[model samples]
Target chain A: MVSRGRPRDMQVDERVLRIAAALMLERGYAGLSIDEVAEQAGAAKTTLYRRWPTKDHLAVAVVARLQADDEIADTGDIRADLVNYLEKIAAGLNRMRAAGHRQGPSAGTVGELVAAAARHEDIGRLTREQYAERNALALALIERARVRGELRADLDAEALFDQMAGALYYRVMITGAPVDRAYAERLVSSALEGNLTCH
Target chain B: MVSRGRPRDMQVDERVLRIAAALMLERGYAGLSIDEVAEQAGAAKTTLYRRWPTKDHLAVAVVARLQADDEIADTGDIRADLVNYLEKIAAGLNRMRAAGHRQGPSAGTVGELVAAAARHEDIGRLTREQYAERNALALALIERARVRGELRADLDAEALFDQMAGALYYRVMITGAPVDRAYAERLVSSALEGNLTCH
Candidate 1:
């Protein structure tokens, strides 16, 4: 038996999402709680609970909101598009890290959440679903490049995606190296051209 | 004035390292305490404290011992050597994760230690020193390949090293991918030849 309460309002959901994003950036997923999220959003606990029951669900919604707002550049050039995408990623990571460090959570908190998700089947599925939705635009750009003969048709798109983005995130999380615009450009350009150039 | 006591035997130092490694693999750096380590190794607390004053120093010693005992393969082929190296790293991470999950700490504990090292200057220096010692063998192998003209002369050995090893660890820690033998080979071959091959 479903109890019918007040009808859901879109504005309240958006506000909740915004609050979740801020808290996630500030305190990390591990440190965040639904009660705090509700209080920060100025919404009742029951209202927030109605929308997303679990912390993972709230995180998925917050990440989805951020991804939706992000603009994917389509300059009709594979190299430029990839460079732009990577630069945005690096910048976003840097911002998250800065914000996290100031707020008690480290920037690597997102990666840690993802790592934890891997161990739980339900959480892992939700995490992947969110990631795929976010990456759809980038995947489309890569596919378009392949069709235009800018990228190697023989290469698997999934593998390429993993190698490029996965490698960058790896460096950021493990080595704590700065991933800037220049580094992103080098990675993309090298991936497109074999290192053994016959100049 | 520093208190002078009987000089500790080197064999006892070796035993402490072994016990520390096992403890770290089980309990992680955070869960490992000096008293516990000493008790586990059957060494006196004074002996442990005399050699290493802090848990960080003791942790560094454990890492150093692991690095010293690690055997890197050089098969006269850059691809094979890289694959071998990555396989070893994957194996170590898997073993650590499995043991850690079973006994003491979660999988994310190692990453937390590495992240802490990034923030603390002294710890950062120690972390870099440990990596340098481990990377020496890898760099030597790459240097040999470059001299043999097997790899492009223009390729930056240090950058390549980071990309190769960094990508694997990144995938494991961030993307939650299985770093099996086949995955290691794929990364090595692609990284060596470049990500794209234009026919």
Candidate 2:
């Protein structure tokens, strides 16, 4: 519940997060440690503890940064805007999939993150809130399009958004399939247009 | 690559799986152990290992049995059929969500199973294949409807199926939302009719 704002020493936080991110991406979740990160970032253990408190918390912060506030564009063309937003999400998933890497189909790091959330109740709640926050932005975008007559008035926006986003997650985490921009386009098309033949 | 079929002792396999499922559901995945299940089921350790190979394999068998053979019903109505299938999937997810007896928002056992698949290459491949098998059934059903002119001939079948199923998973795993029959109906409607207004 504490505010994750910038500390008095802003540069220290940035340096620590950058180093932490690099460590996680290069060596995987098990390889990430505060002591090692401190040694590399030239920051004291106390500062790291004061900020992150635990390894899982630190990992959450690192991922938060990776998500880089992808500004959603509402160019009135809902389809194009949705595609762009989904592409950003695909890019993030691809980055995680590439992290710690794998010869297997599974995205190991993404699984770790999901497990981390399950392991720690705090992490689970935090991640859920983060998802809800992101989902809210998307829902609002859909609502705007509906108001402007770009989409169906009776559309189940929540279900629509969930389907689009869920497909990407399912592919990355379960199927071990690729989630690139091309896949995002395909997802957008399938979700926006009905699969049923017009009666 | 071994066939998960019957051995010389059919009853032994069923008994072991039943106990394992109970242990997993009552005590959770962490509490379900080979030694304990072996002792309780009065089966030799070698027998269990030969059949399951690993705890993950046993767990997979338990889930497979729980899923049963949900006979897909196609009464010349694709929407009703898809809803029935999605509801079955949702029921499985809800059962798993209730497993480990955790009242927390996260489905801990489901998360563990996913991570287990990620950690072990064999498990990952096995689960992927199982999912593929299930997906194939759904795809064939869709193709039948398409042939009958019920659905669009050029519909992105894979994407449509993925979106509907993925949304259920995303809700259960990530958002911790309830995925009941009503939700399945909503998903089917959204996916079939889509969000785009009629031209």
Candidate 3:
């Protein structure tokens, strides 16, 4: 009948993640150590380990916190709403692209997190679940647009979203290209305005 | 005018890579060791080191070979050509999806190679260059389509290609979904056919 965890426990969780995030931003995935985080957060190593069994777990938590602001907006105008959502995603990717003091077009911490997911089965499943949840929201927004006659009745909503989001990721991970508001706008336009010449 | 290297040297390179590829496909990234490769290849350790310098280098080389078959084919029909090229890319991704004896929707060796590129500056640069070259070829195809009026005169060629390829990579790395010819067709259709209602 009571709360799951004491308010005191919640405070400790916040403080530890804050410290861990700082270390990771300053150094990187390699520089993040549970020992250092525990020492800095003034929390016992066992408490941190109990909550996050591995560095990858903690790193994923940090990224989740960073991406907490990526809420999709549906303004009836699908193009405007899509640009806004994609911009939020770009902002998040840019933040991670610079993590670990990396410069240039390197994927930086993002790449390492991806590898971490591959290295651990649990992490992989957890990340895929999170992405699916996020994608479902976007798809629903697209569906609403379709119902309102803003989009074609037979639109491939899944492919539509994947193309936009995937382009951002492709640039960051593969091309080392810059992803920004301009790129987001371009992606939305290309996606919405079919490439085939109109009859 | 002289050859860059003798035929024997080329043969050794091929033999070593073939063996290395087998080990990587069987054991994944962690299991691919230069020492083991050299031992199995019956080549000197120094020779392998001189050529690849690190395990990341060797792994990258192995993937490049695996992807050698992904040559872009432009048969003049932009729609058909795009679907064909995307199918080739999807096939490559599917192969990597199952590397290291992995099951289910895991990214498998593909994720590890991405991390490997991020971990080393040289590898990152090399891989980016390779992607740029391949991207240029795709872009050229799109340009030809535009020139021939197959696509909109004002189409965002870069964005178009990025969306299609990005969707494939996104499914493999982010969503852990199957990327096959069927999905490739869906992506191409969604990309070419405007999503807007007939006003």
Rank all candidate structures by their lDDT, best first, as comma-separated numbers: 3, 2, 1
Q: If scored against the real structure, what TM-score would every candidate get? A: 0.74, 0.91, 0.96
lDDT of 3 by residue, A71-185 (tens): 9988899999999999999988888878878899888888888888888899899999999998899999999999999999999999999999999999998889999999999
Tell me the lDDT of model 1 at A160.
55
Candidate 2 structure quality by residue, lDDT tens digits, A1-199:
7655556479898999999999988877778899999999988999999988889889888998899677788899999999999999988877776676545468677777777777678888988998888889999999999989999999989999999999988887787778878888999998898898887
DockQ of the candidate models in sequence: 0.28, 0.74, 0.84
Please give the distance, in angstroms, between residue A185's alpha carbon in candidate 1 and its true position after superposition: 0.9
Task: List iRMS (one decimal) for every candidate.
Answer: 3.8, 0.9, 0.7
- A15-134 per-residue lDDT for model 1 (tens digits): 888888888877655666889888987899998887787786787577656655567788888888888888887776666555455432233554445444543445555666656666
Q: Rate residue B101 of model 3 by lDDT.
A: 81
For residues B3-91, what per-residue lDDT tens digits would candidate 1 score against the true structure? 44434477788888888888887865557788998998898999899888878678767765665655788888778878888888877
Task: Looking only at chain A, give the TM-score of model 1 against the true structure.
Answer: 0.79
What is the iRMSD of the candidate numbered 3? 0.7
Q: Order the numbered candidates by DockQ, best leading.
A: 3, 2, 1
Best-fitting candidate, scored by DockQ = 3
Q: What TM-score does candidate 3 reach?
A: 0.96
Best by TM-score: 3
Write down the worst ten-residue block by lDDT for model 2 chain A: A1-10
